[model samples]
Target: MDDAGIYTRESEYLDCYVQLGLASDRVLAVSFPEESDDEDADHALLDRIDAYLEGEREEFDDVAVALTVPTDQREVLETTREVPYGEQVSVERLTRMTPGLDASSDEDHDAVRTALAANPAPLVIPDHRVRDGPSGAPPEIEQRLRALEGL
Candidate 1:
C-alpha cells in the first residue's frame, strides 16, 4: 500500500491471469506476472483481512484504497464499500443508492455488474455484499466471504 492507498490486490480466491497492473497506481497495463512476492505487503491490512476472515466482524472503511476506474463505476464501488458487515444488498438496491441511476433499468443493472466486475479492491470494497450478480471474486470465494459475515 502506498501513501495514496491500496491500488491492486491478488489472492488465491482470484483466478489465474486475474488483472495485474505493472504500475504503482492507475493500472497502466494488465498482465499476468511470472511471480508474486508477498515480502513487501502491508502487514496492517493483511492483519485486518485475516481478522475479518476469522469472523471478528472487522470493517474496512478506515482503510484507504485507490480506484482507477471511471467515474460511474467508482460511484457504484464506493456505495458497495458502505455495506455493513453481515448485510447484503441487491444490485437494484445499490443502483437506487446512487444518484441518477434507475434501479429498474436493465442498462443500469448492467452498469452495476460492469462496475463490480472491474472492482480493484474486492474484499475491501465488499462486492459480495452486492447480491444478484458477480462480486468480482469467484463464486466459491463469494460464498466463503458471505459465510464469514454469517449470511
Candidate 2:
C-alpha cells in the first residue's frame, strides 16, 4: 500500500528512466517508470521534480523537505546538494566534504556510503552525481540522468 500523503511522478523527458514518489514534501522512492507501481499524482511537488529532471531548472533548495536522518548523514546529504548539474564526486571525496569528519578512518569513509544508501531524496538531492555511489534511482535512470547532462 502507498504511504499516506505520498505522491507519484513520472518524468516526461526520461519517463522510462525516472519515476518518483514523495511523502510529506520529501522524495520517498525513485525507480524506473516501468518499475513504479504508483497511483497517478499531479501535485506541484512532482512538477518541480520533473522540471528539474528536464533541465529547465536547478536547485531544489526551495522545495522544502522533512527527512528523518541522523546529523552526520544529513550533513553528507546536504553537501551533495551543492553538486552542480552534470558533475560527479566520489564517495571518498564526499566523506571529506562534511565538516569535522575524520577522513583517516575507514569507518568514517563507509559512513558516507551508508548515508547515501539511506538517502530519502534522490533526484532532488541528485545522489546520482556521486560517482559509484548509492542511488535511489535505477541504473538506467542514473544513466539517463547523466545522459541528460551530456556526460
Candidate 3:
C-alpha cells in the first residue's frame, strides 16, 4: 500500500498477500486470489482483516485502493466497493448501479463481467458481494467469504 493506496494482483496461493514498499514503509501491492506471508508488516489494515476473519463485521470502506484499469472498468470496481457487507447484488443490479451502463444490453453485461474479472483487489473491493458473474476471486474463496458474512 503506497501513500495513495493499496494496489493488488490476483494470485492462486492464499486468501490475501501484500508487497511492501521499502522506502515508504507502505504496502505496494496486495494479491487476493492466493495467500502470501506478510508477517513483519504490522498495520491496522491487517488487524481489520484478522477481525473480519474472526466473524466481526468489517466494511473495509476506509481502505484505499489504487486501480490501474481503464476508466470504465475502474468505475465498475469503484461501485462494487460500496456493496454493503453481508448483502449480495446480482451482476445485473451491479451493472445498473454503475453509471453509463444499460443492464438490458448484453454488451453492458459483458463489460460488467470483464470489469469484475479484471478487478485487482477482491476482498477489499468486496467483489464477492457481487454475484452472477466473475468476482475476481476463486469460487471456493468466494463461497467462504460469503459464508463468513453469513449470506
Candidate 4:
C-alpha cells in the first residue's frame, strides 16, 4: 500500500522516507538529509529503511506509503512510468485499477473501522432445526451449531 513509486535510483530517498512514515505509525523515528548535501543522500536513507524492514522489525506492516515531493520534482516522478515491474505506477493510477479493497483515504479509514465494528459475523440461530419433532437436539447437532457460531 505504499503510495510512492518504487525506489530505483539514488536521488528520491527522502520522498521514500516520507511515504514510509505515512504508511506506518511505527516509524516514530526518521532522520533526513542535511539541506546542503548532494541529493544522493536519499539513497542511503532508503537503504536504512530496507534494512529495518528486512530485519523483521515489528514496525513494518501492510501500511500505505504515499510519495510527496516538491512540486518541481513532478517530472522526475513521471519518469517512473518507464520503470519495469510496474512498481513505479503512480498512486492514483494504482487505486483506479486495483479491485477488492478500494483506494484508502482519510475518510475511508473511518468508514472501514465503522463497518468492521458493526458486523462481527457468524450468525446465531436457535437449535430447533436439528432437534427431533418435539425434543431437544442431540450432541452432534449442538457441535455443528457451536462451530458455526465460532465462525
Top model number, lDDT = 3
Encode model 4's per-residue lDDT on 1-151: one tens digit a residue.
4323222222232222222122232222222222322333244335644453333222222322232433322222222222222022333333333233244663433332232222211011122121121112233433433343231
All candidates: CA RMSD in angstroms? 4.8, 3.6, 4.5, 23.0
Expressed as tens digits, the lDDT of each residue in 1-151 for candidate 1 is 5333322334443333223332343323232232455333454455566566656887678765567789999899888988899899998999998777899999999999999988876777788887686776666777878877877
Candidate 1 wrong stretches, greater than 4 Å? 1-42
Worst lDDT run of 10 residues, candidate 1, spans 25-34
How badly does each model clash, as a count of residue pairs?
A: 0, 0, 6, 2
lDDT for predicted candidate 3 compared with the true structure: 0.72
- Candidate ranking (lDDT, best to worst): 3, 2, 1, 4
- Candidate numbers, best TM-score first, in rank order: 3, 2, 1, 4
User: What lDDT does each candidate get?
Assistant: 0.68, 0.71, 0.72, 0.28
User: Candidate 2 regions off by >4 Å?
Assistant: 1-4, 16-39
lDDT of 3 by residue, 34-102 (tens): 444334345566666667767889987877666778999989998998899999999999999999999
What is the overall TM-score of model 2 with all chains considered together? 0.77
What TM-score against the true fold does each predicted structure earn?
A: 0.75, 0.77, 0.79, 0.18
Query: Any runs in candidate 4 off by more than 4 Å, and if so which?
Result: 1-25, 35-59, 62-86, 97-151
Q: Taking the tens digit of each residue's C-alpha lDDT, what string does model 2 give over 12-112?
A: 67665345555545565555556456666767666766777767656676655556789988888888888887778888787778786777778988888
Note the residue pairs that clash in candidate 3: 1-27, 1-28, 13-34, 13-35, 14-34, 14-35
